[model samples]
Target: MPSTPHRWITTPLTAGLVRGALDLEPTAQGILPHRLPAWARDQNTDGQLAMAESQPSGVRLVFRTRATAVELDTLPTKRIYVGAPPRPQGHYDLIVDGRPAGRAIATGGNTVTIDLGTGALEHGTGPVATLRFAGLSDEDKTVEIWLPHNETTELVALRTDAPVRPADASGRRTWLHHGSSISHGSDAASPTTTWPALAAARGGVELVNLGLAGSALLDPFVARTIRDTPADLISVKIGINLVNADLMRLRAFAPAVHGFLDTIREGHPTAPLLVVSPILCPIHEDTPGPTAFDFSRLGDGRLLFTAAGDPADGAEGRLTLNVIRDELERVVARRAANDPNLHHLDGRDLYGEADHRELPLPDRLHPDAATHRRMGERFAAHAFASEGGPFAEAEG
Candidate 1:
C-alpha cells in the first residue's frame, strides 16, 4: 500500500465515465445509478421495476490513471427471499488496458428481505464497504471497474495513488440491446461475463444494455427510450418475460411487438436491428406460464422456479415459447418486406435442444455462466462475423 497520505487523490465517483445506466441521482450518502431515466421511472411505482432498473447490469467505471493501487467505497443493496439461502456478495471486475486484470468483492451492504407469500419487505442497514486492488503496473493505463450486475450499487468514493481522468471512448460501434432477466446477467458469475457483455467484447462493439429484469413488458416508455438513444446497432430479445409473467395473450402481443418495432424504426431507420425470440426452456416450451416459485426444495435451502400454467391453455390465447417463436417470425417476415434493415433470429440458434442437454439452466429459467459464454460466442459468430451476418459492417 502507498504510504504517502499527501500523494493519494480522492477522485469524485461522478468523475468516472458511467455507461449502461440512463441516470445518476445524488443521494445523501452517495450517488445512485439507475437504468431508466427519471421520467420513465416516475411512470411506474412497481417494486419489480424499481429493483430491476436500479441494478445496473452493464454499467462500469472507466478512467485512466497511473496509480498502482486503488480503493472504492460503495453501499450495495442486496435482496434475499425469506425462505431461500443467503445471497452471495456482489463482484466488481477490473480491466486494465482493455484486458481482464482482477476482481474483488464488496463485503458489507444493506439487505432487503422479502416474504414471497405475504409480499412483505423488510430492510436492514449495513455499513459501506471498501474494495481495494493493488500491484498494478506504474505505467499509465485505462481502467474499467464493472459494477455488480445484480446489486443496486451506490457509489460513495474513489481513491487512487494518482489523479484520474475519464478514459476516451473506443469509438467502436455502439450496440444497444434490450431484453429480460436473462439479458440482465442473472446466474452469470460476474458483470462482464454476462452474455451481452461477452458478446460486446467479441463483436468489438460498445454495449448499452437496457436489460430490465422481469420488466420487458413491451411498454411504450421502453420503446421510446430506445427510439431516442443513439445507436449503430440494436437488438431486442422478446418473449420470455411475457410468457413467464403471463401478462398478455397472442392478440395483444402481436400488435405490441409491431408498435415496439415501429417506434424503434422512427429513430434508427437504417441501423441493423435484430429481433431475437426466447431461447428454449423445456418447462415453458409447450406449457404456458405464470411461472411460480417451487417451494418444495425450500425445506432443503434450495430455491427453484416452476411453470405454473397448462399447455392446453393456448386455445385461450395463452403464450408458450413455441407460440411466441411462430408469432415473432411471422411479424418480422411481414415487416421486412418494407424494412430491409430489420432481421430476425430464432433464439434456438443460440441455445437449442442439443445445447440444453449439455448445459442446463440451473433455475430452469436463466442460463448459467458457461451457457452464457456459449450464447455470447454463438451470437458473435451469427451476428457479427465477417460473413454477411445481420450486424455486418457493410450495413453501416
Candidate 2:
C-alpha cells in the first residue's frame, strides 16, 4: 500500500489517454478497456474470447504529467485456484520516457475460481483497490501505466499530484499482432514484458495486440477487427489455439485460413502482412488436441498441460501443429506470389526444438518469463532488424 497524498487532483480516464485498446466501455466504477469494439464483441458467443479480449494484454494508460506521485483506483478481476497454489496477483507496470520505471500490484477486487475437474466457475466480489507510485521526477515526461496482461481491470479513478493530459504519439509505425496465449502474455512476468510487447519495444512501434488467450481461432470477427484497425505492420501467429481447442478439422481449416486472410487483405491489401505458424510444442507436434490439464502434478500445486487427442486420428483429418504449420506455409507461399506484401515466417525460427530443450515451457503449454524474453528478442531480430527482415521499413 502507498501513502495517501495530501492534495490529489483527479483526472478522468478517457479513450484519448489510452493506447493499444480498440474501445473503451463506461462502467459503473469508471471505464473498462476493450481490445475489440462492441459490435465485434456482440458477434461472439465463446466465453473464453469474451474474457480474453477484456484482459488488456497490450493495453496501457498513456499520458503526460509532471506529477511525482500518481494513484490509480481500479477494480481488477483475479483468478482463484481451488486445491492449488494461489495465482499471483496481476502486475501494474509503469514506463517512463520509454524506460522501465515503477511496478505495483492491485490489492483487491473481483475473483473467479474454475474447478479443475468440473470446469465450474465461482465468482467473488471485493472492493476497489488503489495502486500508487510516488517520488518521481517532477519535470514533464510521458508515462505509460501498463495494466495486467492476465487480469481484467476497470479504471475507477486516476489521481496525481499535478494535472495530467494525454501523451502525444510516438511517431512510430503501429504493429497489429494476433495470436494465442503465448502472444497474450500467459505466464509472462507483466504486460510490457509479453513477447509481442517486448518485440514492439525493440521495433520502436506502437502496438495493437489482439493476442487473446486460448481464443485466437480463425474467427471471421477477429479477421474483421484486424481488417478495420489502422496498422502499418501486421502479423498473425496461428495454429496453437486451433490445435488445443480442436475447433475445426483439416477440411475446414484451409478455407478458414484463406477466408481469414482474404478478409484482412480487403482492408490492408498493401500492408506488409506476415503470417507466422506455431512454435515447437513437442506435446502437440504430432498429436491432435483438446489439450487437457496434466493433473498428475496438481497434487504438488503445479499445473501442466497435455495433449488429449489420439495420434491415429490424423487419418480423420484432425488438426495438429505439424499439419497446421505445413498448410500455413503453403497458404503463405501461394498467396505471396500474387500478393507481394504478404509474407510467411516459420514459428520454429522463433522457438524450435533446440531452444525448447534449452528453455522448456514451464507448463507444457505456455512459455515462462525467461522464454518470453528469449522469444521476444528472437522475434525482434527477425522482424525488425535493419536488413533482410520482411517487416523492414521499405517492405511494401
Candidate 3:
C-alpha cells in the first residue's frame, strides 16, 4: 500500500489563542472594515474597544507551508452569512495557491458558498472571474487565501489541516512598517511588489504593514495598534499624506509624532523604531501642498488646471516634504536621549538625487513598480540586514 497521507487538524479556538499569534494587527480603519478572527474586537472612532462590525474586503489569511504535500478539508455544513445592508453587486474570485480556483457571485444577496481546492483560497468581487493555475510545481508554497470586499460578509469558520501557525516558528525577528498608499501597494503590478513587501522579502524578516491610503494622519489608534504589537524592527514613513490631505499644521505635527512614539514605546520598550519622512515630490518638495485643481479640457484634447492660481496656494505652515523632514529629525533627536531604540531614515536616501534622474515616480505622488524594487533593495542594504550596519544594532 502507498504510505498513509499525513495530516494535521485545525479548529476554531477562543480569540485569545489568536491574539499575539502574529506580530501585526488584523484591524484597519477607513473604507476597509476591521477584520479579526471570531474573537477579536474593533476600535471605535474615539479609540474605544467595540465589537467587530464586519469582515475585511481584501487579502486576510497569508501563510507559507513547509509540507510538500497538502490537503484541506472543511465542515460540509458550513454556512456563509451575508449580513444586512446588502453589498454592491459584484462577483467574487476564489483563488487558491495564489491562482484562481473558482468564483462566487454576489448578484443580489450577500452570502455565497465556494469550493476552493486543496490549495490556498482567495475571493474577490467581480463581473469577470477567471481561475488559472498553469505553472505550479510540486513543492513547498506560500499560500494567500484572499476575500475581496469581505467586509460585507463574514467567514464564520474555517477548517483545514494546514497549520495555523506562522512559517517562522523560531521567532527570529520581526519588521513593522507604517506608511501611506505607496506602502499599501496602490498600483504595484502585484501584491509582492509593494516596497514593504519587497523589503520584507529581502530582509529575511516577517513584516507587518500598517499602510492606509489617505489615512495615516498620525492617529492615536494607529500608534496604539503599533504599540500593542511586538517587533524587532519598526519604521514609519510620514509626511506625504499629511501634505496631500492638509491634515495638520506645524503646531500640531511634532507633538502628535512624539505621542505616537511614546505610545509605541509603551508596548515595545526597546524595539528599534525608525521614523522616515517623505521622498522628493516636485509639487510639494518645497511648496506647500493641499493643492487643488479643476480639470477642464479645451475643445482640443488638452487639459488645464482651473484652480492653478487659487488663493489657498500658500497658507501658513501648509504641508511640504522639506518642512516635515526638518521637523521629523528634530523630533527624533529630542526623543533619542530617552529612547535609545528610536532612529530616523530620510526618505530621500531611499530614492533621492540620483534615482529621480532615471526613474521618477509616476504621477509625482506614488512610486512606480520600478521605484518600489529600487527602494526595497536600498532599504534592505541599509536597514534590514542582520550584520553590523546602519540600523542593525538599533533593530535589536
Q: Over the stretch 1-396, how does candidate 1's per-residue lDDT look in tens digits?
A: 235557689887773468777889998888999888889888886799799989989999989999999888899998988877776667999999879999998877898999988989999999998888889999999999999999999999888998799988767899999999989988889999999999999998888888889988898888888999889999999999898899999999899999999999999998999999999899999889898888887778777889999988999999999999999999999999999989999999999999999998877898999999999999999999898788878746
Task: Arrange candidates, best lDDT first.
Answer: 2, 1, 3
* lDDT, candidate 2, 47-131, per-residue tens: 8899999999999999999998889999999987776678877999999999989999998799999787777899999999998
Stretches > 4 Å off in candidate 2: 1-6
Displacement of residue 95 (Cα, Å) in model 1 is: 0.6
After superposition, candidate 1 runs with Cα above 4 Å error: 1-4
> In angstroms, how far off is 41's CA in candidate 3?
9.1
Compared with the true structure, model 1 gives a TM-score of: 0.97
Better of 2 and 3 by lDDT: 2
Per-residue alpha-carbon lDDT of model 3 for 1-396, expressed as tens digits?
112333434433323222122222332111222422223233335211221123222333444544333222111111232221222232234334545544433232223433222223233432212222223344555544433321233223333344544333255467777777666654454445567767776776666666665556787777777777667778898988787667788888899988988888888888878898887767777666564532333234322222122235445666577889999999999889888778888999988968888986555566777988888888888786667543564443
Q: How far is candidate 1 from the true structure (C-alpha RMSD, Å)?
A: 1.6
TM-score list, all predictions: 0.97, 0.97, 0.65
Computed on alpha carbons, the lDDT of every model, listed in order, comes to 0.89, 0.91, 0.55
Model 2, global lDDT: 0.91
RMSD per candidate (Å) reads 1.6, 1.5, 9.9
Candidate 3 ranges beyond 4 A from true positions: 1-168, 293-315, 386-396
